[model samples]
Target: MEQANQNQDYQAGDIVYVFYRNPHTQDVANIQAAAVVNHPEKENELALFLYETYYPLSDEVAIYSTEEEANQAYHYYYGEATEGVLE
Candidate 1:
């Protein structure tokens, strides 16, 4: 019930920041804008249809629940806070 409520709270056009690292180099690869498209078919899931294309698409979405979480992940990975939202 709580998960369903959270999923309902997010709708199309909401933005989610995804932080990811390079597999080979083990460096901060990119911070991407993951636009929330809809709720996933599976329960308690967020679906992102848009994102910045830096590396090849892998299974690592690195999705965060909020902006603060995203920023924290960014800082942990890149040693700095994210600057601006990606278009």
Candidate 2:
């Protein structure tokens, strides 16, 4: 298992849920699974890429500092319970 780096609280291989939103429609299409690739040069940042390919559309990505925050946002937008991770 990957361990969280000192710069951020997330490991390199840790899995996080991503709430993908449509750019034009401004609607949340679905939740996705993403892995923590690495921390970017910026402070307290986790670089995440999508784990699945669906809808194949551009989306607005929101990175939260905690899973709870992500879950809350997911529910708020999509009315569903989901989660993610951030730095």
Candidate 3:
């Protein structure tokens, strides 16, 4: 999903939520990440990611280093494709 702030289009430093369907189940995932920068190869796609949140668990939380990684994570968590927007 895409959202504009102050009537301006989305850009780096803007927080965004990416929603995607679970690959196994028909669920949805809402992952938050920051836009890294403009991707020349992919005009519509931007580099985004989420860091592992602080938690006391055996494994660290998921952190997608790239937009594709995050997108794959969403798809894996949810069952279908997802669309997102500013929350």
**Leading candidate by lDDT:** 1
Candidate 2 wrong stretches, greater than 4 Å: 1-8, 23-25, 39-46, 51-72, 80-87
List per-candidate RMSD values in Å.
Answer: 7.4, 9.5, 13.1
TM-score order, best first, reads 1, 2, 3
lDDT of 1 by residue, 1-87 (tens): 011123235556776566545567664466656677545554645566653323222244566556666666666655754452233
Q: Model 2 over residues 1-87: C-alpha lDDT tens digits?
A: 222223445656676666655566664355556676644454544567574432211134454444665666666765643322233
Q: What TM-score fits each model?
A: 0.44, 0.43, 0.33
What global local distance difference test value does model 1 have? 0.52
Give lDDT for model 3.
0.44
Give per-residue CA lDDT, model 3, range 1-87, as digits (tens). Answer: 222222334455555444333457664456565444555455655444335322111112343444665666566654465563223
Measured by TM-score, how close is model 2 to the native structure?
A: 0.43
lDDT of 2: 0.51
Weakest lDDT window of 10 consecutive positions for candidate 3? 52-61
- When sorted by lDDT, best at the front, the candidate numbers are 1, 2, 3
